[model samples]
Target chain A: MIEVRNLCKHYGARKAVDDISFTVNDGEIVGFLGPNGAGKTTTIRILTCYHPATSGSARVAGFDVLSQSIQVRRHVGYLPETVPLYPEMRVREFLRFRGKLRGLARGERETCIARVTERCWLGEVVDRPISQLSKGYRQRVGLADALLHNPRVLILDEPTVGLDPTQIRETRSLIRELTRDHTVILSSHILPEVEATCGRIVIINRGRVVASGTPQELRSRRGDGAVHAEVRAPVEEALQAVRELANGAKVTADAADGWTRLRVEATGDLREPIYRLSTQRGWTLRELRRDAGSLEDFFVRIVAEAQMQAPQ
Target chain B: MRATVAIMQRELLSMFCTPIGYVVIAGFLLILGVLVILTEGFEPGQPATLRNAFGLMPFILAFVVPAIAMRALSEEYRSGTIEGMMTAPISDAQLVLGKFLGSAAFYAVMLGTSLVYPILMQVYGSPDWGAVLSTYIGLLLIGLFFLSVSIFTSSFSSNQIIAWITASVVLASFAVGGFLLVRHVGGFWRQLIQRANVMGRFEESALGLFTTGSVVCFGALAGLFLFLTIKVVESRRWR
Candidate 1:
C-alpha cells in the first residue's frame, strides 16, 4: 500500500514532479504512465525515499517516507531505471547482498535468494558475473534483487525496458503474478504494456496527474462513440456528403493516399447510418469500423495534447 | 548497521573479485621493494629504513589510491545504482562509514605488504625496529587519509576520470607542502603554508616521536573528507 499527496520536486525553477498524488491499495498493480521527463521517475524516487519531496508526504505500507524512511524501505523493494548493478558481482551474490541489506538473517538470505532466483528465472545465470549477462538477464538480476527480501511492496521503474519481446511478456506475467501477494507500482511509457500488466493507471503529463482510472474506464470516459471511416471517393465529396448527412455529428477529417478518412464523434453508434449513406450515394466504403479505444489512444489524446498546450 | 556491513562485505569481495586489488597491491609492493633495494645500493652506510619506502608511497598513493577509490561511489552514481543503495534501509552515515572502512581496510592490506621491507632490513643490518614500525603506522595513516580524500572526490563526480583528477589535485596539494613551493613564499606565509604539510605529520610520527598531535591531524583529515563525502552523496538525493 502507498499514499502520496501534493508531491513536488523542484530543481530550481523546473518542476520535475509537480503537484502529483496517487494511492495504491494492498495487492493492487498500479501502472504509472508518462512520457519522457514527465516526472514519473521523480515521483517514484520520492515514494522510495531516495529523494526528499520538496513539499509533500508519501507513505508506504503505513510508514511515512520522510519521517520513517527506514521502515518504508524495509517494506518496499525498488528497481530503479537503468538497473543499478555492480558488474563484477555474480547474480547470486548480488541477490544475497540485497537480502542482507533488507535485514534477512543468514539462512533467510540464502533461502530468499534461491526463491527469487527461481521466481525471476535467474537460476541458470546465478553464478555468472553480472557484466557477462545479457541485457535481459541483467534486468532479471535487478528484479531478483528487488524481490529477494520478500517485501510487501514493489516499485519498479521501467521494469521491462530493454528486454526482448519474449522476455518482456515473461516479465509482464511475472509482475502480474507478483500482485497475488504484494502491492506493485511500476512506471512505463509503453501504454499497451501497462494496460496488459496493470490493474489501474495514474496518467501523468507535464509533471501533473491528468487522469487516473482503470484502462477501460479511461477509454470509455474519453470516448464519444467515435468511429474512423475510410471511403474510396473524392476527398471533398466524401467529406461534404458525410457532413451534410450526419446533421449534428462532429467530424475531424483528413485525407491520405486518395482515401477520405473522417473521425466522426456521435452521440450514439452511427455504423448503420454511415453504411446506408455510403450505399445510397454509390460511395465505396473501404473501411468503416468503430475505433477500438485503447490506452495508447487515450494517453496520446489526453497527455500529449495537455503537454502541447502548457509546455511544462 | 547491518546494511552497512552487508555493503562493506560486498565491496571487499568486489575489490578482490576484480584485478583492481591485485594490481594495486602488486604494483605497490614491487615498486616499494625495488625502491628499497635501490636505496640500499646507493647509500650502503645510510642504513636501510622504511623511511624511503614510506616516503615514496604518498606519491604512489597519489595515483594508486585514486584508481581504487575513483569508483567507490562514482560508479553507483554513473550506473544509477546509488538509487538502490540509498533507498535501502540504511542511514547515510552508515553507508559512508562502511565504505570508508572497507577501502581503509584494503589500504591496510596494501600497506601490510611493505612490512617485508622492514623485515629485510632487520635481517641484513641493525635498523631501528621502533622507527621501522612507527614509519609503517605513519604510512597506514597517510594511506587512510588519501583513501578518504579519493573517496570524497569520487562522490563529487560520476565520471571516474573526474574523480581521479580531483583526488589527485587534492592529494598533491597536501603532499607538496612546506618543502617544494613554500620557499617561493615570504617567511610568515611560508610558515602558514608549512602547516598544510600532511606528509610532514607522518615524517614526525615516523621518527618514533609518537606525537598525539600527528595522529589527531591524520584522524581529523580523514574525518573531514569522510564527512564531506557523506554530504555530497546526501545532497544528490534531494537535488
Candidate 2:
C-alpha cells in the first residue's frame, strides 16, 4: 500500500533520510527498525505528507505524496511519536472532531467514535478531558484517533514508547489484530517488540535502509553458522583435528580445566562431524551446540556495517 | 467548507472551555464601562450619545484584541496539537479561515456585550441611530483587522506572550503611530500615515460616513494578514 523510491531529505548540510527505498504491501504489518537519529521519524513524516521529501517520490495507496498529499492523507492514518492531542478536549469529543475532519458522515462518525473508543479501551474515560488521563490512556486515545476514519493504512511512529508492560502487550496484540484488515508500518527502536508483532522488518541506519526482510530470513541470511564444542582432550590436538576435518574453517580454541572449548565457523551444520570425531578420538564430549543467530544480532551487525560504510 | 466549520467549532469550544474567554469578556466590559461611566462623566440627564464609548474602541481593540487572539495558533503549536490539525485532510487555507472565523466569533461576542451602551442611550436620550449602527459596523471592521494581525503574529511564534507583544506592536503602529507621528511630519508623509491609520478610517465610519473605500480598506488589510498567515503555515512544510 506504500512505496518509496530513492528518497533523500536534507536539512541544510545534515541529511535526515538519504536514498532510502522500501515498500509495505497491503494487509501486512511491517516494522520499521532503527536506532535514535536513524531517520525513522523523518521518513514517516514524509510519507504522511507532513513534510516534503527533498528528492525522489513516495506513494501511499496509489497516490503521490507530493501531488496528491490530501488523498494520501485521507488513506493513511498517522500516529506521531508524541501523540498530538488537544489536552482540554474530552476523549469522545476529540475523536469526534477528528472524525469530522476526515469527512465522516454524521451517523458514521458517531458509530466510528463508539467503536474506536471501545477498541482502544477508552470507554471509561470517554467523557473526561485528555489532560486528566494517564500516558497509557493518552496513547490509546491517539490510537483511537488514528483509527477513527478507518483508513486503509496506519503509520505509527514509536507507538509503545510510554506504555507499561501490560499496556505494551495490549497495544502489540491490538496492532496484530489490525493487520487482518489494514496495512501497518510501525517504527520503533525496541527489537523484541517488533520481533513479536511484525512479520517483516526493515532496519534503517544513518539515513539509509541497511536491511529489509522477514525476521527469520534476516537471521538465517546474515547469521554466523558456527558449532561450539567442549571436549575432554588436549587443546592443540582437538583444534588440529577439527581444523583438518573442515577445510577453510576458522577455529578458535580456549583451554580451561583440561577441556578444550572450540568454536568452529563453517558452512552447514558441523555438529554431526564433530560428534563423530569426539567418538573416534575417545574424547569425552562435555558440550556440543549449533548457534542459531537472533534478530538482535542481525540488527546490530547490519547497523554496525552501515555505520562503517558511511562517509566520514 | 465543512472542514472549516468543524475546525472553527472546535476552536470556539476550546476557547470558551477555559477561563481566558470569560476573563477577556469581563475585563473588556469592565474597562469600557469605567471609561464611559466615570472618566467620560455620564449623568442621569446627560445626552444618550455613545461618542465616548465608540471613540475609544480602536485604541481599546489595539491591546485587548491581541490578548484574545494571541492563543489562537500559538497554543496549538506549544501543546503540539498543530500536528493533529495539519495532518488532517484540510488544506492550509481552510485551517487559517477556520481559526480566523473562530477568533472573529469570539471578538463579536466581546463586542456584543458593549452594545448595552447604545441601548441605554436609546432609553435615556435621543441618540442618532444611524451613527450608532455605523459605529458598530466600524468596530467590527477594525476588530477583524486587529484579529487578523494577531493571528498572523500567533502563527510566527509558539509563545503566547511573544505573540501578544508582537501583534500589539504591529497594531500600535497603525492605531497610535498615525496620530502621534502625523504632528511631526507634513505634506505627503502626513497623508500617507493618515491613510494607513486604523483610527482615521474608524472615525469616518463613527461619524456616520459609510464609504466603500473604508470598508474595502479594512477588508484588504485583514485579507493581507490572513494571506500572510497562510504563507507562514504553508512554509512550515518546507522549513
Candidate 3:
C-alpha cells in the first residue's frame, strides 16, 4: 500500500531523512521503530504529503506523494504526534468537520462519525467539548478522526505516548484489530507495543534503515545464541566442568546460596554438552535455557552498530 | 469549493465558540457608538448624517480589523492544527480563501450592526442614500484589505501578539505614514503618497465620490495580499 524509494529530506545542511526505502504490503501493520531523532516522523510526514522530499519519491495507495498528493491524501488518514485538534469543538462536531473536509456526503459523514465514535469508544464524550476530555480520550478522538473516512491507509506517529497502562493496551489491541482491514504504518519508541501489535518491524537510525524483518526473523538473525544454566554444586567445580565441556566458549559464572549460575556465549548449542557434564558430576541441574534475542535488545544493538558506522 | 466551505464553517464555528469573536464585535460597536453619537457634537436643529460615523471608521478599522484577523492563522500554527489542515486534500488556495471569508463574514456582522446609525439619520433627517451605500462599500473594501494584511502577518508568526503587532505596523504605515510623509515632501513624492494612501481612497467614497479608480485600487490591493498569504502557506510545505 505504501512505497518509498531513496527518499531524502534535507533541511539546509542537515538531512532529516536520507536515502531511506521501504515497502508496506496491503493490510500489513508495519511498525516503524527508531529512537528519538532517527527520522521516523520526517519519513512519515513526507509519505503523508504534509511535506515534500528534497530528493527521491514516495507513493501511498498507488498515488504519487508529490504529483498526485490530493489523491494520496484522500486515500490515507494521518494522526500526527500532537493529535492536532481544535479544543473548542465537541467530539462529534470535529469528526463531522474532518469528514466534510475529506469529501464525504452529509449522510455518509453522519454514519461514519457514528461508526468511528463507537469503534473508538468515544460515545460517552461525543457531545462534550474536546478540551474537557482527558489525554487518553483526546488520543482516541484523534484516532477516531483518522478513521472517520475509512481510508485505505492509516499513518499514526507515536499513538500511545501519554496513555496509562490500560489505555496503551486498549490502543494496542485496537491497532491489532485494524490490521484486518487497513494498512497501518505506525512509529513508536515503545518496543513492547510494537512487538504486541505490529506484524513486521523496520528499525531506522540516523536517517537510515538499520534493520527490517519480522520480530522472530530479526531475533534469530541478530541473536548470539547464548546459553544460561543454573546448577546446585560447588561453584568452582561446576564452572570448570562447563568451561571444559563447551570448547572455546566464553563463560561467566556466579555462585550464591549453595547454587551456581553459568552464562555461556557460544556459536553453537552448548546445552547438551553442559547437561552431560552435569549428569557425570552428579550436580543438580535446576535450569538450562537458550536465549533468543528480544526486540529491545535487537533494536539497541542495531542502533548502536549504526552509530558506530556513522561518520563523526 | 466544498472543501473551502467546510473549512470556512469550521473556522467560523471555532471563532464564535471562544469569547474573542463576541468581545471584538461588542467592543467595536461600543466604541463606535461613543465616538459617533455621544462625543461628536451635533446641535438638535442641525441636519443629521452619518459623516462623523464614516469619518472615524478608517482609523478605528486600522487597529480593530487586525485584532479580528490576527488569530486566523496564528492560532492554527500555535495549536498544530495547520498540520492537519495541510495534510488534508484541500488546496492551499482553498484554505486561504476559506479563512479569509470566515473572518470577512465576522467583520460583516460587525458592520451590519452599525447600520443603526444611518437608520437613525433617516428617521431624524433626510440623508443621501447613495452616499450611505457607497460609504458601506468603501468600508467593506478597506476591511478586506486590512484583513488580507493581517492574514499574511498571521501566517508568518505562530505568536498571536507578534502577528497583531506586525499587522498593525504594516497597515498603519500605509494608512497614516503615507499622509505624514506627503506633508514633508514636494512634487512627485507628494502626488505618489496621495495616490497610494488608503485613507484618501476611503475618504473619497465617504464624501459621496465613488470612483472606479478607488474601487479597483482597493480590490487589487486586497487580492495582492490574499495571494501573498496563499504563497506563504504553500511555501510552508518546503520548510
Give me the runs in candidate 2 sitting further than 4 Å from their true place: A229-248, A251-262, A272-288, B119-130, B181-195
Off by over 4 Å in 1: A226-292, B41-48, B179-197
Q: Give per-residue lDDT, candidate 3, residue B63.
A: 78
lDDT (tens digit, per residue) of candidate 2 on A98-161: 9888999899999999999999998899999998999999999999999889889999999999
List DockQ, one per candidate, in order: 0.68, 0.75, 0.85
lDDT of 3: 0.89
Best by TM-score: 3
Write down the worst ten-residue block by lDDT for model 3 chain A. Answer: A290-299
What are the RMSD figures for all models against the true structure? 4.6, 2.5, 2.2
Name the better of 1 and 3 by DockQ: 3
Interface RMSD, per-candidate values to 1 decimal:
1.1, 0.9, 0.7
> Candidate 3: where is the Cα deviation over 4 Å?
A267-281, B38-42, B181-195
DockQ head-to-head 1 vs 2, winner: 2
Q: Which one wins by lDDT: 1 or 2?
A: 2
Error of 1 at A258 (Å): 20
Q: Please rank every candidate by lDDT, starting with the best.
A: 2, 3, 1
Q: State the C-alpha lDDT per candidate.
A: 0.84, 0.90, 0.89
TM-score of chain B of 2: 0.94
- The pairs that clash in candidate 3 are none
